[model samples]
Target: GRQGSRSVPQIIDDWGDYGAGVGQVAASRMAYRYAWSTTLDLE
Candidate 1:
């Protein structure tokens, strides 16, 4: 799943204008994952 998900952003990033959009989406996903893991660690 991780490899597949990572490839998706790379494909989007190759689309010129969509590169920035993909970066934002990837950053948001990373932040969400970090927050979720932190919450899990707190439990």
Candidate 2:
């Protein structure tokens, strides 16, 4: 088992907790999924 690890900036960057207004969440989610799928040859 590996111990968890994260610096403050790294944690904040991954958390995305700051206010995301409008369609930000959907847009970000779509972008992430699209990029991931394409990179993995799923799309």
Candidate 3:
């Protein structure tokens, strides 16, 4: 479902790098969207 056995901080650290490599605003928006969608789907 998610990534490896990393904590939330670790995950966000990776996300920051990935986001920076891509596009900061876009990557952050997408990450938030994905997180919200996943939570809604789970519910």
The candidate scoring highest on lDDT is 3
Q: Using Cα atoms with residue i matched to residue i, what is each candidate's TM-score against the true structure?
A: 0.60, 0.45, 0.47
Which regions of candidate 2 are displaced past 4 Å?
Answer: 1-22
Error of 3 at 40 (Å): 0.2
Say which prediction, candidate 2 or candidate 3, comes out ahead on TM-score. 3
- The sequence of per-residue lDDT tens digits that candidate 1 reaches over residues 1-43 is 6654657676666786677788999999999999999999999
Determine the backbone clash count of candidate 2. 0
Order of models, best lDDT first = 3, 1, 2
Judge candidate 2 at residue 37 and give its lDDT: 87
What would you estimate as the lDDT of candidate 3? 0.88
> Each candidate: what lDDT?
0.84, 0.74, 0.88
Candidate 3: tens digits of C-alpha lDDT, residues 1-43: 3555778898899999987877978888999999999999999
Q: For model 2, which pairs clash? A: none
Root-mean-square deviation of candidate 1? 12.4
